[model samples]
Target chain A: MNYKTVLTVCPYCGCGCGMYLPVLDGQLGQPIPDKTHPLSEGRLCIKGWAASEHVVSPDRLTQPLVRTGDDLKQATWDEALDLVASRLMTLRDRHGPDSLAFLCSAKCTNEENYLLQKFARTTVGTNNVDHCARL
Target chain B: MNLPQEVLTEETRQIVSRLLRDNQVVGVIGLRTEHNHTGPHLFTSADDLKELTLEPRYPLATICQAILSSLSQGKLGVIVRGCDERALIEMAKLTNIEMERLVLIGLSCSEELARQCRCRRPYPSHIDVGEIVEGVSPLEDTQVRRLLEQNVEERLAFWQQEFARCIKCYGCRNICPVCICTECVLKEECWVERGQIPPELQFHLIRAYHIADKCVGCGACVAACPMEIPMTTFYTLVQEKLRELFDYEPGLDTKQKSPITTTLEETPLREL
Candidate 1:
């Protein structure tokens, strides 16, 4: 019988609403907006209310896959990364760095996105870096 | 769309009986079928078990208030949905119902019904007897979003055209679980003015503001509105914005308090 609430900040946006993750048997119960928190004042939007749904979602991806003969086949981490690097390098050589673009994710930490942008600029030689959050 | 009437399982019946047998709730409030038409009704000790129908259609919150007001002393148990829970939670905040005395038996809505309601969370978090399932997050309304993208004048004009269909039946207020005041501000001659068609945009604005923190997104207001104004979409947007700004979801937890009741200093913006 696991029962505990971990106070964590909502990562959807910069608002950083305070909420509690109710842990039950290693599975997370729905988020309860922290009433004592400074920002939310005990009200959550649809995203905040349903924040926990994604964590346990069966559709959530767990492994890397590459398109192989119309079907995506699971690939080892090194193979996947090597394929990506080789493709990116080929594209940059063929179409120039200005033609290549990179998209970041809200799911990743800010430092991760910063590193991705740095890799795009210094390694890939492209300035066209952006984030899905911009949408 | 008509609700699924035949889906009531035997487990639900037993649960209802067990609840009534155990607690002295004023009554179990839910929809019932009588004279071949279904509507909200209260189930009492004397009422036949056969009369308890969970399907067809019902304004559950309205029936709940009636039960609460008529018999103020006894604790009441309600079979609530996500929206009903939100309304009840907001009502609890306003002191409309005694929280300690009340017991809530939540019933989760199905995915198909949830999608129709554009509900982000279709089920209540704390349920006495029901299987928990994942709910779908609804897509934002295109019409409302398009209207919002327009300038102030266009938006005002659009609302003016929509509100013009109002018959002033007060069905929206009468059916709302959150609009619990005996004397409503919208009815006052000073605030809303008498003999006004559409009740002015300000009237709607005031109504929206009054329930800003409390609107449970039950769509009861929309369902009750004979005029069929897209009130749910508006309320949903406002509710979403509130959650975005504050990160609060209503009715899931009884111990939690709304941000509106507290001073801003106590609940500062997270980014700030």
Candidate 2:
């Protein structure tokens, strides 16, 4: 009997369209545009409307996986991060910093993206910084 | 029929309050005004009646479907306008809603709102509170008339230019109350190629034909579209054609099967 809409921002892109996710009996429902939102003005792109699909999708990843031979096996966060750091260092040492490229996502926050580019430029010493939203 | 807006609102509130007090329904689903904003709300008690405000409309029928599906027992009340009531009837026909376990509180639309939507029927079957205003014919709209006047080539060119701005946003389909398919053909790569912006014209044509017998003229698709494509005008034309060909108008009677979905025996084609 409990039904309410939770006003939140769309997680798909940087447009930050305001949307309302209907919650019925603690389950997330479809997304609807927030009419009162000054920026979006009651309009949403395709991604914004389907933003809640991944939250309940069965294919969504919940844990990190490390590739071994051909298959990927579940691993702890500590193990995954250590593996990434070591592989990155080895690649940097073997190849020039210019060979390394950093690709950021619109799903990440501004601060997270900034830190990623900073790490690429300062720590790895690479100018190959790219973003998914560059298009 | 010429009552002031405030008087209608007050009358609606009193009726809802009475329904809540008498336990006619466990809850009344309507729009609740809060902080100068309004959204769909489920009023469980009479105390919340003061916040009930009806002005800017939302797809209340969709919310009603959500609530009714999840509700295990007891009947639920919903405030429905013409479009909402029509949508509910269509949903019931499709077995998406249990019409028996629900009560409809009809609310008539204002003439201005009716004209804005270009709705053919602005009021529900029965008006509980608000005045019943005249329905606006879709042909009265200049855009619809102009589009109708265009030849086949001109119409194709016009739609091509308009659909070019489409971002492939499914807002129109998502907001439609009668579009209750769990697996949509629009998402299929076979029907519509993946990663193609401004999807093939078949994308729009498929959707148009699918909902031809079910469209309730809610104008939600037009409002939800980011590109502001004149979808209502296009659907209204389809509706007009259906009327002329079969004398079939959807959402008017739940028992009457859509001419497209039925066999010749069930719903015979009208003489041209």
Candidate 3:
């Protein structure tokens, strides 16, 4: 019965169009463009309007996975993060920091992106940062 | 979208069924499909009311205007959401619809449905059916405000970038509830040249000015746009300007007159 609209910037591109992700009883209903949005002004591109599609998508990943031998197995956050951290450290130490590339995601928040880049540049000492929407 | 809410369907059905069986109006117009698919249907019999649905869609009042124009005389019943009711009021003031002959069966949309449409006023001012839910706050349009804040050159550049994506399908004009003209200026070569991909800025400007007074803020144009042009923001700006200038809000009350049609003596123009 509870319904709320969480205002967010579109993650598809740098355009940063504003949209409302409708949450109805805890389920993502649809994405609606914000009319008063300074940038987009209530108009949505195909991607912005269909942004909610991935939320409830059956094929969407529900858990973190780590590759084990040939097949990947679901693992807890601590286990996954530890494995990733150790693997990335080994790659950086052996093949140089530039061998590892850090990719930022549009799905991630601004703070998260900042943290990712800082982790890559300062911690891993790599400047190879990229974005999925680059294309 | 056409599927009735599992909780409210029975109550809504009973109301529609009674309205049809009692012959309150010659026909009751409502949605007849479900599951993100729907179209307006005019129910002439109580049996047809069985198919009546409350889909999260349908531009019923606009279709009703089209129907009303062809008919000489007939009382019509329409299932109206907040925007539909407002649009009908705007149309009636323009003489496009006969308000007196129409019976409105108002329905308050669920908050979830309201949020989906980005509706400011999801429920009609008056309701004849459905549980009354409080209206949610509509998101503000910073784009329009930013455009208004910009210098002429900056505004022009902004528009150039925005309209660059226009496939010029005229979905915004076609889907707009307020855009009921015998001959729209947008179609005219003098205003918008044929086969123009990113149409001349005048094309949008003309349409924007035309619906300024009448736009009910329905976001149908936005949804219909294949290119996903943010047409509603333009109309939203227009409506806001109309409100500020004339202190007249469209589709709020049937008795209220549209300043655009009224003489200056009746509704004096606001000072610039």
Candidate 4:
């Protein structure tokens, strides 16, 4: 009785298919396809249907990690980002920028992705930038 | 707004309101609006019955099945299309639902919808609303026919090309009403082999055989497939074969059992 559907685009792919995230009393329900959306037209791939799985998954990572010695220790965003930046700079300076590779996430925004490629090509001076979207 | 379809819908609303007030059912499962999109919803009180609708068809049986399984008690009603009623009947036969605790409010589809579904029997045998119209003759599955017509080598090549487009999303299995098992064979590495795109032919054939006798021809599998692989044609072909061999039609009568499940004494293949 307290059910609701939030219309949104699929977060997994660059296809931007519309879907409805059904919420039952605040819990995630199945994702139904957006019928009127021109791209999806009430059709969903397997990923679209199971989009709710990751949200409530107990195995979802809650924090970033930093390797102290052998084990990965939970760390704050600042600690993690600093570690990554310092490591990237050291790795780039030790062996030219060509040795450093940048990987972009499809889950991030276009602006965020733009920042990634720019960082790699300008700051890192590396053409070894890649995206998760194979196509 | 006194058009025939509108009048029937009004009657349905009145019936639902009365049912709620009379305590005939604790909840009514039907299509509802949320964020401007209409899909399956459970109307618990007569006050929320206004949200019920008949447009933008959905597989209400799936919703019904989900709710029924979650509940240990309580009777429920459904504003069902012919296809929905048929699906419920099939579910009842499979023991997936308790027929005694469920209410069926059958609604006949319009001529246009019948054409869209290419349905042979567009109207439910029972009626709670909407006038029964003529059922359309089933549209020929030209794709399936053409495949069957080819020589062995050509058939192999044709299916290879078709299956090659499969992203192996398994949308067909997820949306199928008959597929209620928790452990599906297609998911096992031993049976299907994971990490491979365009799943092996054994994958699809396994599913086709599983739902051959149980499919209600609701076309949800075809509608949900992202690659638009005509999944319905495969199931429809199998249904046609069942009709030819044993004269068994699923979702018709509760008394009639599937050919595969029935004993020879109860449902003989041929008359003496």
lDDT of 2 at A125: 98
Residue B114 error, candidate 3, Å: 3.1
What is candidate 1's CA lDDT for residue A86?
93
Q: Give each candidate's interface RMSD in Å.
A: 17.3, 1.3, 12.5, 2.7
For candidate 4, the per-residue lDDT at B217 reads: 87
CAPRI quality of model 3: incorrect
lDDT string for model 1 (B111-195, tens) is 5677777788777767654455566454356775786678989977887888888766565665567877777888788887787
Return the top candidate by lDDT.
2
Candidate 3's residue-wise lDDT over A1-135, tens digit each? 333446677777667877666554477745655555667655666567667788789989988988989998999999999998899999989999999998998778789999999999999998999977685
Model 2 CA deviation exceeding 4 Å by range: A67-71, A78-105, A108-132, B1-7, B33-37, B46-50, B263-272
List residue ranges in candidate 3 displaced over 4 A.
Answer: A1-135, B1-4, B34-36, B72-74, B136-153, B260-272
lDDT of 4 by residue, B193-257 (tens): 88788888888889877888888888888788878777776677778778777888889987778
True lDDT of residue B134, candidate 4: 72
lDDT of 3 at A31: 62
Sort candidate 2 into its docking category.
medium
| Stretches > 4 Å off in candidate 4 | A1-5, A23-29, A76-104, A110-131, B1-12, B34-36, B45-51, B139-160
lDDT of 4 by residue, A30-59 (tens): 777776577888887778888889898998
Q: Which predicted model would earn the best DockQ? A: 2
- Residue-pair clashes per candidate: 9, 0, 13, 0
